[model samples]
Target: MPSLMDTYIENREMVQPNHANNLDTVHGGNVMKWMDEVGAMSAIRFAGKSCVTARVDEMDFRRPVLVGDTAVIESYVYEAGETSVDVYLRAFRENPRTGERELTTESYFVYVGIDESGEPSPVPALTVESEEGERRQAEALDGLDA
Candidate 1:
């Protein structure tokens, strides 16, 4: 079994001109790409094998990340089936100068583990051994109802 903590992943990307839209804010597509990459990392950590995106449960961009801000994406595996890992992912817009951050987006991503032959493979069971992990898992489960 792999604990939720073991599957945790966080990444940061600086929003540059190339990643921005007409409003000089980070594009939604770029944010989605970042979420997918971070979510896949968490899934791979949990499954210990190559993983591919199976589904995106939902993606909501509540706020925009400005061109000068840093986009921080955090991800963790909350549950797993035989070949599927469900990951909770969230992004924040962070000000580098002030260290202030605000929630920018959130999404749930499902990944399927694959073997060397590129076929579906079983993933390890997810364990919420820590109280924090349990709380996170609970939150993720609750979000599925919304």
Candidate 2:
């Protein structure tokens, strides 16, 4: 089983023209798609099996990620059950010129492991055995309200 940090997956993509709205800010749907993809990556890495999105507990856009800015997505496994894993996803806007980044979105996603037959299956235990890992897991679970 992958540990806390080891189960993390990230992706940084540029906000293209089609990814923006009339105001030139990244579209909310596009951000949600990115978050779902990155969260799936973490879930797959942790469970080592095919998984499906069971539910999105909450997704809230704190700020807009503008076009030309790098959309940095960070995701990790926070909790796991017999056949489900909870993932915490965060999106940030990275300025190309200053190389600074700021949080823009946050959400918690749940995925269920699937077997070769496409049926839900149990996943292995997760290891959150470090100080930072424990803190992050706790922080992610602080408020499911998003």
Candidate 3:
């Protein structure tokens, strides 16, 4: 069994000119791309197999990452089913100089494990070993109600 902590993933990308929109902030699509990549990595770590995006829950762009800032993405597998895994994803804008961080986006992503033949495959069971893991799982479940 893989614990949720084992599947934790964090990544950061510097917002460059190419990554920004007309407003000089990171584009929403670029942020989504980053989220999906990190979310898939978490799912693959949990499942120990190839995983593909199945769905993405509502994503609200609450803030913006300026061109000189860094986009920090965090993800973890919070729930699992027979062949699917649910990942909790959050992104923050961090000031490279000040180290200040602000929440920018959040969403739930669903991924399905795939076998060697590209068919759906069973995923490993997720074990919540720590208080934080339990809390993350609970958060994922609570999101379902919203």
Which candidate has the top score in TM-score?
A: 1
For all the candidates, what are their Cα RMSDs to the real structure? 0.8, 1.3, 1.0
> What is the per-residue lDDT of model 2 for residues 1-146, given as tens digits with 9 covering 90 to 100?
67988877889989999999999999998999999999999999999998899999667789999999999999999989999989999999999889899999998999999999999999989898889899888889785643
Tell me the number of clashing residue pairs for each predicted model.
0, 0, 0
Task: List the candidates ranked by TM-score, beginning with the highest.
Answer: 1, 3, 2
TM-scores for the candidates: 0.97, 0.95, 0.96
On TM-score, the stronger of 1 and 3 is 1
Per-residue CA lDDT of model 3 for 1-146, tens digit only, reads: 99999999999999999998899999999999999999999999899999999999999899889999999999999889999999999999999999899999999999999999999999988899999889888887787787
Worst 10 residues of 2 by lDDT: 137-146
Candidate 1 lDDT over residue span 29-59, tens digit each: 9999999999999999999999999999769
Off by over 4 Å in 2: none
Candidate 1 vs candidate 2, TM-score winner: 1
